[model samples]
Target: MSVRLRTALLPLLFLAPTLSPAEAQSGTRPQDVIITYYNALGHKNYAAAYALWDRQGQNSGKSYAAFKNGFAQTYATYVAITGPVRIEGAAGSLYATVPVKVTAQLKNGQQQSFCGNYVVRKNNTGGSAASQVWRIDRATLR
Candidate 1:
């Protein structure tokens, strides 16, 4: 029937990535990068999580100062993560370099891509500078 065909084909239609490869690699999806950083922040691993931000991101409005302050607010919200975050096509070439994919979701409560996609990084020295493990998103999830 027409209804059945449209329903079946709707999923394939939304599978397409809205942004280009470069944009898609911005890094802020899934549970790997951002979530890990969230956990580190929650655990008071400031040194470790702070190192995960990209150079550009650190320079943006999301600087170290902003991170500390914003984290305080984020912690105030949502009690805990509900379930396992699903990230499609997650890749890490090395300890510092990782590529993230674009997120997808349906209008209805049918499907949703794990919040974001980001590549996490570590520090080089005594908080000397934030290394590049993964890029960052302008939006931070709780």
Candidate 2:
């Protein structure tokens, strides 16, 4: 499976519960936007990756440099995910619950598999140029 598809799917899975006010307007189809953003990240498209972030910076923030570093590090830390993703959506956004297995190849190579969730939004929200960027609103490991 493509990395983008993998990345996008994870958020959709955890997007259950209810919609938030942040996402007022949504794209006709959000899955496409999610997948595209991840695809861009895999290709080393920093700008494209940034586009995937809301850029509002709840905890992440508006600085491109900070966002880039955070984005790259997270991707680098988790090699990949395994299994089908569960998804949820509200208003104009979606979340994915991704099953992940991570083993620090350097420290001990101990393999572990667990589900992690990510929330994302489609641009169109008016804020700083970066706020319109798509991004992982929050990620939780279950």
> What are the per-residue Cα lDDT tens digits for candidate 2 across 97-133?
5444432111132323445544555345355644443
Error of 1 at 140 (Å): 6.1
- Tens-place lDDT per residue, model 1, 10-127, is 4543233333223323444433454454445545456555554556546335666666665452321111234444333334222332233323222332332433323333332333
lDDT of 2 at 83: 56
Model 2 stretches astray by more than 4 angstroms: 1-34, 55-59, 71-115, 122-135
Among the numbered candidates, top TM-score falls to 2
User: Candidate 2 — worst ten consecutive residues by lDDT sum?
Assistant: 102-111
Specify the highest-lDDT model's number.
2
The residue ranges of model 1 lying beyond 4 angstroms of the native Cα positions read 1-30, 56-60, 73-133, 137-142
Pairs with steric clashes in candidate 1 = 27-117, 27-118, 28-116, 28-117, 28-118, 29-116, 29-117, 30-116, 119-134, 121-133
